[model samples]
Structures are given as C-alpha cells and as structure tokens.
Target: MGALADNRRFWLACNLVTLVLHAFGVYLYASEGFAHPVAQLWAIVLMLHMLEFPLAFIAVRERRIGWGVTIMATLIFGFTWWVPTRRGVFHA
Candidate 1:
C-alpha cells in the first residue's frame, strides 16, 4: 500500500490502543466502586477523550460551530484524528 494508507493504519492501531487503555483504566476504577479521588471524573474524561477526535471534526463542520471551540477541540484531539484523517478523509 501507499505511504498515506500505511500511516493511517498505524494510527488506527494506536487509536485502538488508546481506546483499550482508557477502557481498562475505567474498568479498574469501576472495580473499586470509584472510591478514589476523582475516579468518576476520570471515567468521564477518559471516555470523552476517546471520542474527542470524531466529535472535533463534527464540531468543525457545523455551521453554528465557533472557531474557539474548533480550535480547542483540534488542539485536544490532535494526532488522535490527525493521523487517520491526514488525507482530508478517513477510511473508516
């Protein structure tokens, strides 16, 4: 395959790792009944972090979206969506 395709596949694999890691972390927290400091907050943040990529793009495309929001989202979602969609479109 081409370089772009290869690069995307690599990032997709990394995204999968991110998803699994966050899920595992959340699972550990849940197992403890979320008694630790900000465990609930961690769960919420990590889960949202996983979706931040796709959501950022959606935010950018919306007509009513603000530049500030888009910029912040882009910054937060950097490389998470950047690699997979580097070609101006994503494979999946």
Candidate 2:
C-alpha cells in the first residue's frame, strides 16, 4: 500500500485477517487448555494487539489514517471501524 493517502477502508479491510487469526487462536487456546504456554502467549499477544483499535480510532478522529497505519492494521487486525479518510471514503 502507498503512504500518500489516508486509506482507512483499506486499513479496515486488512484488519479482517486479525479476526480470523484471533478466532483460530481462541480455538487453539481452548483445545489446548487455557493454561498451555502457547495458548497463554497467543492470548497475551492478542490483548496487546487490541490496543490498536483505540489508536485507529484516534487516527480517524484526526483524519490522518495514513498508509502506515493502514498497512499495519491490515497486517494486524484489519480495521475495526470506518473513517472518512481522504484517500478512503472521501478519496478523489
């Protein structure tokens, strides 16, 4: 993804992968027993990854959801919300 645009939707789209990964992680956690070291580690990563939601929210409010955030979110959880970013909803 290019950086010269505020591709909020793209960011959100990318976030969908995170959902799938999280779901699978949850299943593994349950199947392996909640206290399993791998499960615990996945849970911790998920918890920390969740912080991106608020950060994305802030970016939306600022109208600055750049490609960096978008790609990161895409690589991560995908976006959890929509924003009228210049290169996204309001793109010319």
Q: Which pairs of residues clash in candidate 2, taking residues 3 or more apart in a chain or in different chains?
A: 12-79, 14-78, 15-77, 15-78
Candidate 2 displacement at residue 87 in angstroms: 4.9
Tens-digit per-residue lDDT, 32-54, candidate 1 = 76776556756665557656656
State residue 84's C-alpha deviation in candidate 2, in Å: 9.4
TM-score leader? 2
- Per-residue error (Å), model 2, residue 48: 2.0
**Candidate 2 Cα misplacement greater than 4 A, ranges:** 3-13, 34-38, 62-92
- CA lDDT scores, all candidates in order: 0.56, 0.55
User: What's model 1's overall lDDT?
Assistant: 0.56
**TM-score for all predictions?**
0.43, 0.44
| Top candidate, metric lDDT | 1
